[model samples]
Target: MGFADYPFTSRYQTIDGHRLHYIDEGQGPTLLFLHGNPTSSYLWRNVIKPLRDRYRCVAPDLIGFGRSDKPELDYRFLTHYHYIREFVAALDLKDVTLVLHDWGGPIGFRLAQQEPRRVARLCFMETFPFTFDWEEFPLAARPLFFAFRRQRLSYWLLQRHNLFVDLVLRLSTFRPLPRSVMAAYRAPFPDARSRYPIRVFPGELPINDRDTEAHRAIEEIERGLAGMPQPMLLLHFHPGAVLGRSRVAWLAQRLPDLEVVDGGRGLHYVPEDRPERIAEALEDWLRRRLPEPVRGALPAARVAAEDDRFGGALTWTFADTEHGGMVAAWSSHGLVMLSFAEDVDDGRAQLARRFPKASLEAADQGAIANLLAAPAATPLHLVGTPFQRAVWRALLEIPPGQTRHYGELAHALRSQARAVGSAVGSNRIALLVPCHRVVPRAGGLGGYHWGVARKKALLAAEGVKEP
Candidate 1:
């Protein structure tokens, strides 16, 4: 499809004296699409067109790519991060749903973390922000790595021979890209000299803590994500035969709220193969995360009456009532504060302490108890930092019967196994949310809030065939 035929309205904005190219279309809630290395807003062409009518889609070509200006400034993390912040500010976007892929993860993630209230949800695909050890890099990337480190030599070769754009397009995909797509990607690099950022990107990958330029920026972004509570969706692509699926699984475990979708192309560029899926996932998440308008306010008495029913043992009695489910109750008060006891007296005392002034009474709310006793079909709400939220959201997407290791979830969350485990442990609503489904790398039952026995029982109940 030709670029002109697309439904988007093209425009440019001046951010910090540089002209930045962007596409805005549709008219409902706002959706910001951030591009990764060697690609521009054009990467989201397919996504924008389909979603325009229902959403206001804004995809910006990072400062150096597409129609944006290629200034002679250092193309470091801070520079890009500042440019994105300026671009969003210039446009005055609010309550945005961010779609990030590849390097877009850090760029978009930083923006969300900086202004958490403005970002309702996030959709991450085939990207990482935590850390990627060089040992995990694919064999094909070794040459690219070596070329990047030899900055002077690499720049000379890429710019002199006009190989940067061509090589990127060629190696970015497992399947061959069409002539038109190739043209679109390479169109920005009219000459080798204009491809400085392309050369700089690979060189900037933090191989160690010594690379303070990019490493510190990434670490800061990781810290931000660890605490963000916005809902996150993780698209776990196949890393490659060498990396294995375990890495992605590790990410899911650490991120208590992640909703991982399968069938992505690979680590290099998932956007090229599954742009629509990523866009749709973002759309759905936006709908869920953004608060809806209350339809006609209820009278205080009515609200109080309802609260009263849910106040004490009365809450147990209404367990099966319209809004009296245990999950619903915990969802409102937060899981950390809710308590359950073996005896009625103990439970009553706990409830009194938990909700001091709220009335306390008891009734047999069997249905709510049953619901909690059963495996959850509804996904759990994982509360944590933005990165942890992203990781947890990815975890939620792991199919009900399937299990992934801590390391696999880490790779998907773009963090480490240890970080993933910490997030998993932070998961509030346990059984109903299914944090129990996550296991260890060695195929043993990992830790669970309720207990390992309960975790195993829940997993078995969900039809997980124990090995």
Candidate 2:
């Protein structure tokens, strides 16, 4: 369908002297959509229309695309990010649920990271942060990106010819893009000069440290992901050009609260191919998180064969401790995380990062509170690999008063000591998982995920004091 076929209100704001266009429809909590290369707010035509009645849905054309003013400036990844940050600020958006694809992922991620309070929920479709060694690229596509370094030839394909609209987009999308939609996509870049942003995008694919800004942002995004408590939803498609099966799984594994829904027979342009499924995926997740009562107009339709509607919910309680306070969290499976620190926020942040989609709340005033008040023995649901799980079980085997060095557990598991140390570092259940019991063989405590002083206190409480 053409942009006109799916109608909505079009709005613009002068962000940094340049007018940026966006689709702003519906009302109530804001749901912001960010587009990538060769596409603009038009990409979200199908997604925004369906949920406009109950929610204020927005799809913005990045500076160079759609009706936005295409300024003649060096368009780097950071440049796009600054514009997006300014767009959100200019509108003074609050409690935003971000729907991001392609370049939008990194741009939106950095914005959310810097201002966590403004953003509440996120939906990632056919996207990955720019990090990792060049060798880590998916085997099928490595050659394509590797060859993109030949800037002269790549620039010809991007600027001289309408390769993205005429060839790449058509190839990437599953559904046929009729003449009208093609005309809409081609409408922006009437000539080579306006397509400079597209020219820079391909070569700017952050491989290794080559794209320094992207590389640093990737590292920070990956690192910050482990701390960001926002609930995330991922739409995993069959064949994205770069984001393949392995990349999707790796991302899902890291975010404790990420729910993955299958986008059938779709590629990198999954948004174009499967907009109905995409809308449903966001709608289903928002139903659970939306504070207001679910309205009738926003009907919940189940999307795809693989339903990822459930996850990232945690039942937690806080109790006063001698050192400070402890937060105990439990999943439906069992007691999953136990943590002691100065306040409950540390544990909450950890659980939020680990189970990004899980609901976290205070335990009722009863036995649950008693459990949080003290380290009540409960069956643990460990979060890790087989080796990590085995290492944690080994730690649990240690008598409360006794301690084991990293080497001792490694030898017992018949694995490398570093592997044991890594697992110890990742332990979620803390005292119950008993990772604090594992220490350095040399002398002083090796490390603790919580704190060295807390580790010492736990050890001292059990009879073995920290060196």
Put down candidate 1 lDDT per residue, 186-289, tens digits, no spaces: 88888876888777776677566256678778878766654665556776667632224676676565554456666456646666766666667666655554
Candidate 2 yields a Cα-based lDDT of 0.72
Mind giving the per-residue lDDT tens digits that candidate 2 earns over 1-467?
44347586778999879999887898866899998888998888888878888889988899898999998767888888888889888898866889999888888888878876577668888766647666666575556556555677666777788676777787777788878888888999989888878777766666764747666776788778755545677888886665777887787667644667776778788878888889887898777545421111111111100012226456887666555666777655567666664666776776667666667777763534555455444545554433455566687788888988888876765445665787788776766667888888899987988788778888998899675
Superposed Cα deviation of residue 74, candidate 1 (Å): 0.9
In the order shown, what is each candidate's alpha-carbon RMSD? 10.4, 11.7
Tell me how far the alpha carbon of residue 452 in candidate 1 is from the true structure, in angstroms, after superposition: 27
Where is model 1 more than 4 Å wrong at Cα? 1-7, 239-244, 297-467
Best-matching candidate per lDDT: 2
